[model samples]
Target: MTREKSQSIASQKLQQKVKGPVAQELKEMVPNRKSHQREPRSKDAASNSPVQASVQSIITQIQNGKPNVSGSKETPEDLSFVMSSIFPKETGSVDTSNLKMKPLDYERPDVPRLSFGLERVLFNPGVYHLRDPRSRVYNFDPYLGAIMPVSEFDFDALKAYITSSKDETLAGIARAEKKKYIGSSSSMTSVLSHFHYLLSNWRGVDTRMMSQNFPDHMRSFTRLLRSPAAMFLRYQNGSYAIDADKEFDSANILMNLGKSMEKLLTLPKEDFERYRRTHENKISAEEEQAIPEAYHYSTMGDFLMRSQLDAYDPRLPGTGMFDLKTRAVVSIRMDARNFEHGLGYEIRHVQGGYESYEREYYDMIRAAFLKYSLQVRIGRMDGIFVAFHNIERIFGFQYVSLPEMDQALHGQTDTSLGDAEFRLSIGLWNKILDKVTAKFPKRSIRLHFETRDAQTPFMYIFAEPVTNDEIEYIQTKNQAEIDAYQRRILNLEPKDGNDDLDETPASPEKPAANSQPTAEQNAQPDAQAAYDSSAPPDESFLAELEAEEADLFKGKEIMAMTLVVKNLVNGSPVDRPMVFRADDKWTVEYELSELQGKQVSRLYNACQTRREKALSGRGEDEADAASNVYIRRLRDLAMKGRAYRAKQDDFDSKHGTVVLDEDV
Candidate 1:
C-alpha cells in the first residue's frame, strides 16, 4: 500500500484499531542501538557491576535456553534474544523424528511478556492483492493497473490459496515469463528463515559461520552485513530493492499454472474445453496480470505475521489458505564466487520438457519440502498447493494438506506436533522482543547467530552509531543549516534607517532580499540529452528520516528506483550504452549527496532507456532521442546544485538525528 493511501484513510475507527505498541511503526518495533559509553573502573568493579554482570548473564541465557531434557523441564525460546537457528545439514532438511518439545511453563518464566499481553490475531492489516509488479512500485491506486483494491482486511477476511492440477494439460497452453519475486519480500526471509532451528534442532546448536541448512538463509545474512553503509540503506534510500537472481526463481510458465489452476477448476468441463482450445491456440507476448496478493496480518502471542496469500477457497480443507508453490525440476548449480554468502545461483531461464526433469522430482522434494512444510505450518495455512512443471511445460500438481506434511515431518499427521511448534515459535518471538529491546533500547544493531552441534545457539549483536563518512556528510549539512539560520536572523534584524531599499539593483544570478531564485538561476546550462531543468533537491527529503505515526514505508520511501543506471547492458558490448561516460562518474559520486544520487540516477537511466531504443534503429524509436534532451537538462541541474551548495542560505536541520559514538 502506498503512503498516500495510508494517509488518505479517512475512517478514524480503522486508524485507531491499528494504532498501538504491538503493531507499532516498523522501525520503533526493532529499534537501532547506539554505541556505548563507560566510566573507568577497577578490574573487580568492572566485572562485578550490575550493568556488566547483567550483560554477561543475558548473553549466557540467550545461548543456553531453559532446560528441556530432564524428568521435568521447559523448552522456551531465548527470552529477550532474537535468534536464527542454523541447521548443520545441507538443504536444511532433517528427519522430524528427532524433535523433542514440551508445553512452555510461564509461571517460572525468566523473560518479559508483551506490554499489552498476548493475542493470536492483530488488528486490521490492510491487505492488497498484488496483481502486478508495477503495483509494488506505484500505489495500489485505481489509476494504475492495480488488480486488488487497497483497504483494511477486517477480522473476518484474510485466509489463503493455491492451485494444483493432476496432469500435463497446462503445458501446451503457451508459456509466459514470471518476474523476480521469490526474494521480493525481505520480511519473509527474516521471519521464516529459522524453521530448521524450531522443528529439528531439539538441541540448540551454535551455528555461527558454520555450514547452513538452507542457502537463502545464509545469503540474506550476508547481504545484510555487507557494509555499514548498506545496513540502513533500505530505510535511507530504498525506492527499488534488487533481489538475488536465483535459479528456480522466475519460472514464468509454472507461475502461470499456479495462478490460473485454482480458478479454472471452478469452471464447467465444456467451458474448460473451450478455454483450453483458446489458450493453446496461440500464446500472446503480453503477460497476464499477477493474481491479487491477499495479506493476512495477525499476531500469535508475541509473534506478528503478515501471511502473503496466493488464493483462498473455503471449499478446500483446513483454513483453505493454501500457499502457492511452483517446483521446477532442474537441479541447482551454486555460484561460489562470493564465498561470504554460503550459496547463490546465477540467473538463467531454463527451457526444458518433461523427460528432462521427471527423474529429478524425488530429489527436488528432498531439497525443498522441509523449507516448504515449515512455511506451511508456521503461517498456519491449510497446506501447500504445489504445481509441478519444468521450465518449458507443466508436469502435474499435488495438494499436501497440513496433516500430510505433519505426517511426513513428524511420525503422525495429528496437530499435536504442529501445535507445539506454533506455540513454541510465537513464544520464541516474544522472548526475543523482550530481551533485545531491554539490551539495546532504541538503537541500530547487527546480530550474528551461531548454533554449535548439540550445543546452545547464541546471537552476538552490537549497536551501530552513525559512521564517520555519514558524520562528515551530516556536518556539511549542519554548516549549511547554520548559515541559513544566520541569514534569517540577519534579515529579521531591524535594518539601519536607509540600508537595503537604496542598494544597487540585485543581479539576475542573486535574488533580492531573502527570496526565491530568479528564472536565470533556475535555467541551468549543460542542456545535453541527459539533463533536466530542475537543480538541487529540497533538503527536507534527506534530513531526519522519522515520523510520529508509522506506515509500511516508515515515512521515508521518497525514492523507489533501486537501479544505479550504470548496469543496463548485456555482454561486453553491453557496457556501451548502460554506463555513464568516465567523466560523468566522478561528479555523480563525489559531488552529489545521497538525495541527489537518486535524482541523477533517475535522470541518467531515463536518458539511456531512450538512447537504447534509438540505437536499435527502429523508425518510431526516435522519440527516445527527444526525451533524452530533457533528461540531460535535469542531470545538469543536479550537477549545478553541487557547485551552488556554498550559497549556504537554505534549509532547517531538524536537530540532526545522528548520535555521536563514544569511541569517536
Candidate 2:
C-alpha cells in the first residue's frame, strides 16, 4: 500500500478511537447531515466533504511550516488540531490506571480535621483535575508545564517524563540549523545561551549583572528557561557559584531569590539606605530614629518594571518555619488586622506601602501561597513556608518616615503608645501585641513597636527572655493584674468556677463562656491543670508555671524586649534596657500622620457609605454587615475610656479616627 493510503487508514482508526467531546465537535462541524438524504458535494472535493477539505488544508499548511494563520488567511481551527492537542499521538493509548479521574491523595486528608486553621488552608493545595492538555482551563506557565503531572498518583514518573521531554526539546533545539537562528529573537534560545554562558563561566552572574554586563537582549532570560539544570547561585568558597548539583525549579527559584534574583529584584540594603539618606538630605529626629537597617529592604524589580510584569513578587516572604516531617516550608500570616483594624499586608499594592483591606490583596496573597505550595508538593522545591511576619521595620519606615509621616505627624502632639484615652488606642495596641505573640506559639516572632516620636524602639522576641529585671517586673505586674482581673471577672459571674473570661454567657443560668485558650496555652506543659483553679494549686508547681509565664507570657507582657533610648538618626536597632509595666496603658501608635488626613477622609466616607446603605435597607447584605462590623469595631476602640462618640466625632470628623493629638 502507498504511504498516503496507510496514513489515511491510520487517521481513520485514530478517529474511531477519539471519542467524546472532540468527536462530537467534529461530527457537528460536518455540513448537511440528514437521516435519509445525502449531503451535496463540490466539484474539486472529489471524495472529501467540506469539513475534510478544511482539515486537510490546515494540516497541510501546518506540515508546510505555516502554523500561525494570518487574519486575512485564517480559517476556523481544524478538528484534528484540537484532537491532536487533547489526544496527542503519544497519549492515544490511554492508561486508565495512571489517569487521575478523582481527587488526589494530597487533596484527601489522611485523617481530616473538622477545621484546618486559616494559615493551614491559606493556600490550599491546587485541585488536580484530569484535563486534556489542549484545554485552556489550566493556567500553565512554562515551568509548571515542565513539572506538573497529569496524574497525581504517578507524580514521580510524570515529573521524570516532563524532564525528559524538556531535555528532548533542548536536544532538538541544539540539533536545529544554526544558520536559521541568525538574529532570531527566540526566548528559548536566549535562555539556553545564557545558561550555557553561565555554566562555561562557572562563576555565576546575578540577573542584574547579566542584564548590565551582557547584551540587553538577555534581561529576563532566567525566568523563561524552565530547565532541570537551573542552579541556586550562591557564594561558594570565596566567589559566587551555581550549586551545579542543585536542580532548581520554580519554587526553588522563588525560595532562593535572595541569592539568585538579587541582582534584578533587590538593591543592596546599604545602597537603598544610602539613597534614602542622601535624597532626604536630613530628617527629623523622629524620622531619623526609624532609619531602616537590619530589616529586609524592598527593591523595585528592574526586570519586572521594564518588562511590565506588574504582578505578585515571584519570591514570597519566608514562612519562618518549616515542616519537620517533610522539611517543607510551612508558614501562615494571621491577617486579623484587615478584619479587626482595617490594616493589612496588601499584596497588589506597591511594596513598602500601606496594606489595606481589599479583595485584590487577599486573592494575590492566597494565589501566590497556593502556587508555591503546589510547587513544593510536586517536589520541585526543597521546602517553602510563607507564614506571616510583621515586617514593619522593613516596609513601614519607607511609607511612614520618608517625610510623609513627618508631614502627617506635623503639628501633632503627644505621640505615644500609652495614650489610652484615644479611641481604640489602648484596644488596638493590645490587639497588635496580642496577635503578634499569638501568631506562632513556641516559634520566635519578632515584633517592633515604635511611638510617634520613633525614639523609643521597642523590640519583642516571642518565647525568649530579655533581662531578668524586665521579666521579674512584668511577672509581678501581670500576677497582680491577673488576680484583680480574675476577681472582677469572677465577681461578675455566678459561683460556678467555670465562668469564661473571653465570652459572655448565653443565658444567666448556663455556665459563662470561657475565654479561648491561646496557642501558647495549648502548647503549655501541664497547661490544663496549671491554669485550672478548680484543682488546688501546688505551691511549687504554681511557682514553676509563674516562672514559665515570666519567660513566655502568652498575651501579657512581651517575653524578650529591647527598648532603645538612643538619639539615633537612622532606622537601626538600639539596645536599651527599659521596663514595661502591664498596668501602664499602651496605645496603637503608627505613623499614620502622612495618611492621617487621607485615611480619615477615606474611613469616614466608608462609614457614611455603610450608613447610607443601611438606611437604604441594603445593610442586610454580607458586605454591609462586614462594613458595619468594621465601623462599629473602630468606633468602639476610639471611644474606649472616653465619655462618648460625640466628643471624639468632632475631632475624628476633622483629623481622623487614628490620629489622637490630645494628652493622655
- Give lDDT: candidate 1, residue 275: 31
Report the lDDT tens digits of candidate 1 across residue range 534-558.
Answer: 2322336322211211221232222
At residue 364, what lDDT does model 1 achieve? 31
lDDT of 2: 0.24
lDDT of 2 by residue, 446-506 (tens): 2222110111221111222123233223224224334433344224334456533323212
Worst 10 residues of 2 by lDDT: 301-310
Error of 2 at 387 (Å): 3.9
Model 1: ten consecutive residues of lowest lDDT? 585-594
Q: List residue ranges in candidate 2 displaced over 4 A.
A: 1-28, 33-354, 357-361, 365-370, 379-384, 388-664
